[model samples]
Target: MENKNLVDDCLFCKIIRGEVPSYTVFENDDVKAFLDISQVNPGHTLMIPKKHITNLFDYTKEDVQRYLQYIPEIANAIKKAFPNVTGMNITTNNGKSANQVVMHSHIHFIPRFKGDGLKLMTRNNADQYDEAKYNEVADKIKAQF
Candidate 1:
């Protein structure tokens, strides 16, 4: 049975159910890893929970831990399968504000090399390291924890 969040319309859910085509690399009861169609790099892949959840904020502690615990094994498999993967980047975009296109929460496993010409970051001119502000923000987040 599907939860209200796991609609047929959700792309990841369709892939999980084999209703849509995907280059599936790994799957367990709780998660699935597949080659990303967009292929940000030659071996870019995605790991997602089999159950649909909108974003990181929607994950329960158990859900998050269970899915994340499999990442290292999945990442190692990707590294072994892809050539010249000197490094990897595990990224998750959380919300619309973070440019999350897919509603389902997923981690991007981007294989990196010495000169792949891929860059995950740019200088944020407005970003500043303010000690006082850092402490204040840390305290607020700590409260939630």
Candidate 2:
């Protein structure tokens, strides 16, 4: 049976179906891990679900469980494959505003070393939030539950 979630023209879906070439590192029935063509680092990798869900907001409960289950194992394999890797960043961009180029949901495993020149985030407004602001934000998110 066809997986209704698979998008016909999605890049990651093409990679998943072997219609596009990729430097695939690992793959199973549920997910595929491959080298990011735009190597932010030497061992930069992308782990994506076989299903073509757009982003985290679209994942079902079972999708989350199956997708996350392979992260630890794949991360360890990446670390082991690269002896110089000191640390790692596992990130997923949720939408176009979040820098998601492709529509498929993917987790990035970026290996980090001291002074790799990659700046993942900056704290420009570290002191902007006070207790009241913090509580207001927290309460808004908590109310959703």
Candidate 3:
């Protein structure tokens, strides 16, 4: 059996280990999603890679393929369950530095509406520098690729 978490005592790992229970939404060979009991919004859901990586950057190619495959279906299921929902936000936090409470590779499908708990995060644009600066940065990134 898998060790489940990168380190033992991980709550999400316990869920995978069946040492604890979660209100699961979907489970397949490589992924699992469950209802967020502490729902940010109704039907709030969480999905995770079955392997014991801590975040997205650690996912192997096969792990990534399997992880991506379930996202659309998971999103569709949540949307279907709450037809009144206006929009959806899929978010993942990477590290403790990023405020990721659980040290496991997981994504969240947070439902959004006109006014709700999920809308707590505000969006703001970063200041755009001159066009020359933008082009220089973009060119450097393109070169790296």
Candidate 4:
């Protein structure tokens, strides 16, 4: 099945087209999973849609369903493959400001162990928001739905 969303010059698109090599771990019609070259941890894997949608904001409901369905199975396989893994981080950055360097929408599955020293999402500003502030923000987001 040809991916209608393929972007000609995108690195991931090249990988998908076999124009570039990748350490591919999983692939189906709609998605591909591969080892991240910059392995933050030993088994860091990336899962990307075969479609070249740039980020979360670009995904349609059908795109989400098609691309996200493989996550759990892949995560479980990563955990099982690395016996020392005690937990994992499943995350995606939506834009350049959020550290999305590739521009192709992808999810990172980084296998974690104790003292892995990978500090993620450390800055917490929970105390800055009171109940009313929380409710106000929630209402604004809920309105979009």
Candidate 5:
């Protein structure tokens, strides 16, 4: 049974409706932020718009504005929740190709400490550098600045 009122079985919608359970931290009229079941660290959190959208790229201007309006407070909540955190990283996964398991627009705030589990490595190879592409990317980013 497809419940049109529920955005076609959205996990976040079920969470908001209390039809499912989650370790939620904050919620308002238009947004909600919750603890990740698979925590990347002590304060890894997922924030989302109350309304359904496949991802951030698909949000309307109103939805975008509404979601951003609440971010600072939500971030502050994370800061308080993870009192020992040294730094924070905010990220969003867009599509299945981008690793988004749930079809909802969400921002993840992952806090990090010195020598924590968020280490990264890069392969040094021919695919790592491209000169023509670098200039084009810099030109595009410069325009934004």
Candidate 6:
């Protein structure tokens, strides 16, 4: 059953409704998995909830739990479908500052190989970090929680 509360102009919502074509991998009551059109790598896949959600912060506890519960299963299936996938990166960006182009929340499963030339992360100004700075940052975050 399609979600009736989908956003009118959300691209992912359109894909979910079959208004746009997608290489679907899996679908269940609350989520859907499909191949990413850009293919960050050959086996790059995107998983999203059936209900339209703007970002991680917008999800309720139950929504977060239900949406994420299918990740391990879908990730393992992707690994099996793609040969020589020694490692994988599962990532989701939140707001615009984080480079989240689509408003809808979605997780990307990117298959990795030895020397695939894809750098998931990079060190920046590591030597500039001091213990006091780290403690201050941690304290601020903990205060909010």
For each candidate, the alpha-carbon lDDT, in order, equals 0.87, 0.91, 0.82, 0.93, 0.80, 0.91
lDDT of 6: 0.91
lDDT of 4 by residue, 69-136 (tens): 99999999999999999999999999999999998999999999999998887687899999999999
lDDT of 5 by residue, 90-123 (tens): 8888999888999888888888877797864446
CA RMSD of each candidate after superposition: 2.3, 1.4, 2.4, 1.3, 4.0, 1.4
Q: lDDT score of model 4?
A: 0.93
Candidate 6 wrongly placed segments (more than 4 Å) = none
Query: What 10-residue stretch in candidate 3 is worst by lDDT?
Result: 117-126
Q: What is model 3's C-alpha RMSD?
A: 2.4
Candidate 4 regions with alpha-carbon error over 4 angstroms? none
Error of 5 at 6 (Å): 4.0
For candidate 2, the TM-score is 0.94
Look at candidate 6 and give me any clashing residue pairs.
Answer: none
Supply the global lDDT for candidate 1: 0.87
Model 3 clashing residue pairs (backbone): none
Q: Going through the candidates in order, what is the number of backbone clashes in each?
A: 0, 0, 0, 0, 0, 0
Give per-residue lDDT, candidate 5, residue 88: 83
lDDT of 1 at 138: 90
Residue 58, candidate 3: Cα error in Å is 0.9
Encode model 6's per-residue lDDT on 1-145: one tens digit a residue: 6568698899999988999999999998789899998998887999999999998999999998889999999989989988789899999999999889999999999999877899877578858889999899899999997
Report the number of the highest-lDDT candidate. Answer: 4
Give the per-residue Cα lDDT of candidate 2 at 79. Answer: 95
Ranking of models by lDDT = 4, 2, 6, 1, 3, 5
lDDT by residue (tens digit), candidate 3, 2-34: 653345677887788777899999998778799
Winner of 3 and 5 under lDDT: 3
